[model samples]
Target: MNHMLLTVRQDANLTDNLVGVNAMEVLINALIKSGAQRSSLRAKAFGGARMVDGLSDIGEANAQFTLDFLESEGITCDGHSFGGTNARNIRFWPATGRVLQRMSTDRLIEPKTIVQAPPEGNDLELF
Candidate 1:
């Protein structure tokens, strides 16, 4: 029941054609070298939470880039989780192709109580 699962972030510019060590091309090559057939390859992508406020949604952009890349490369994307304000924690099991995603939730933290020591008994009467 041993399998290899790879998770990596793509370059900000996917069209640049730069093959970085962690780039998709390298990942596919590594899989091939490890005896996986390209035709049978499948992917499950996660993350891309919109964590900021601005004109550009970087998270959505990255997620879209991944889908586009996989599509262009003829790879099947098994599933995806995308586009949310909350952060996400993803756990993927390659052998089972199972993905567990947990979204960030707001929780109120109770403040700790600070105890102050009483003044020393009359050691220094003068202030």
Candidate 2:
């Protein structure tokens, strides 16, 4: 059986706007050619996060771009998860139209460490 799944990652608008209208139109056209109606198009966007530190965060921009494109094309995005510092693992079953997502933050955080108010004083202490 043939199924369709998409993984979109756009770091920058190099090579004359691959992440913009051109790419979206191509995808849309392909779907239409494959017998999908433009009015019935729907999307689920994922995987846009700040995967690194000390660099420009373009993940949010990419995510926003996709949403904007879908909106402009009259497509419905009923599901999405975007813009964070966590790594995500997504599983989609196209035949059943089911999706699963698991997110893990890259930071090392210990739940046992709890913050307590310090002595009720103006002198602040840095950890």
Candidate 3:
């Protein structure tokens, strides 16, 4: 079977708009609808970097959200590289659930220490 690759981008702000399509709910649903199974699916999560200076903890929130969502769905996240100042490029093979995470240093940005925000209402937007 051909492997499927999913890439989720980074959102600097934890907003309601960031949910929905970007949430793991949608990802898993899409995979299942396409005949992917949780037991057979392995996830490679990436790209939660604090890119902008003096910003809040959006990157960390995104990483946590991903973990929580996966855990809730009983999906195994076999690989992950998150919560860093540098951006990362990742590739995931859905067939075997193998993931490759690579960090980028060519265009690195300095991260600023910021406080995390409180979890608000249901930010997950299901499709």
Candidate 4:
């Protein structure tokens, strides 16, 4: 029962680096190298809040991309909270596949959201 969390935040590097398409590969490889069985691997992604106005909504793009990547790899997406005007806090238990989320924009002043990913299925809950 091993789990992995990929926080897909908008990065300045994503615009020019392989991160735009290879980020998921990196995460999967890291887990494999860490002795995690591919069959037992699962993903719960977070982050990618539209934290700013007048800028591209990279957060949403990153979050959706992450979920799409997981689906393509046949990994179960237990939970996620992506693309919102509010920033979020995600707490995940990799050993148990349990996740908690809270979205708040009142305390912060930025807005962001993430990508164009085709979704295969949906089971994530937003908070």
Candidate 5:
């Protein structure tokens, strides 16, 4: 099976100007355009790490946006790892919705832990 990996950065310009829209929106549209059926395509979201104390909400918002968008689109979220005081190094396999999240605690805050589990089967529906 072939897989595509995409990275979404925190910079708005990277998402908006380059993709011609917001990151989450563009991601969903791309998934559809790429011939991903709602039932067959699963999502595994990562990042949204806070890194800074006061800026924690940004990560939360990103995660929430991702989840809400996926749900509204009737796409299954097979896995996720989100929201922390540290950044993450994530690897995603778009075809299978498999994700690996590795936290980075080199400088700022506490140690990070893995947050999600992979989906079981197609019956673990999203919408």
Candidate 6:
């Protein structure tokens, strides 16, 4: 049986998003809809990094929430890697329930290039 990987977390601003407190509930509903038996399902999770500097540890909150959710659902979390200052990349193999986690030195606040698109059909026509 294949395993499902759920990477859940509490947002930095504590916003409710896809990977928040309802993550397990969402996954369970989807699995049931897809014809999976509750008894046959398990979870493995990763990620919840405190990568941003000078902020609350949302990662710790995320990790704890996930664990509690799994317990409440009676689903075994076979393995997990959560809560740290480093950014992480995950490679998961559902067939074997294997995960490879790589930690990177990249900060969450790294600079990004912002590209602005022109308004539709508004070509700059300077006469």
Sorted by lDDT (best first), the order is: 6, 4, 2, 1, 3, 5
Clashing pairs in 2: none
- As a whole number from 0 to 100, the lDDT of residue 4 in candidate 1 is 35
lDDT of 5 by residue, 29-124 (tens): 676687765456566667666675543355565566667666776667666777666777876655565667778866765555688887788866
Best by TM-score: 6
Q: Each model's C-alpha lDDT? A: 0.66, 0.69, 0.64, 0.73, 0.59, 0.76
Q: If the candidates were sorted by their TM-score against the true structure, best first, what order would they fall in?
A: 6, 4, 2, 1, 3, 5
Cα displacement (angstroms), candidate 4, residue 45, comes to 1.5
Q: How do the predictions measure up, each by TM-score?
A: 0.67, 0.68, 0.64, 0.68, 0.59, 0.73
For candidate 3, the 10 contiguous residues with the lowest summed lDDT are 1-10
lDDT of prediction 5: 0.59
On residues 11-117, what C-alpha lDDT tens digit does candidate 4 reach at each position?
53446235655766777788899988899887777888767666787786677677777787889877776776677777877778788887774544544556677
Q: In angstroms, how far off is 97's CA in candidate 4? A: 1.8
What does candidate 6's lDDT look like per residue over 4-88, in tens digits?
A: 8978554733465344555557777888898878887788988788776677878777787778778877888999989877877
Clashing pairs in 5: none
lDDT tens digits, residues 1-127, model 3? 3233434356634564356336556766777788866576666667677776676757776677777766775667666777777767776665666777778785555665699996688897558
Prediction 3 global C-alpha lDDT: 0.64
For candidate 2, the TM-score is: 0.68
Number of colliding residue pairs in model 1: 0
Which parts of model 3 have CA positions greater than 4 angstroms off? 1-9, 12-22, 107-127
Report RMSD for candidate 5.
18.8
Give the Å shift of residue 116 in candidate 1. Answer: 36
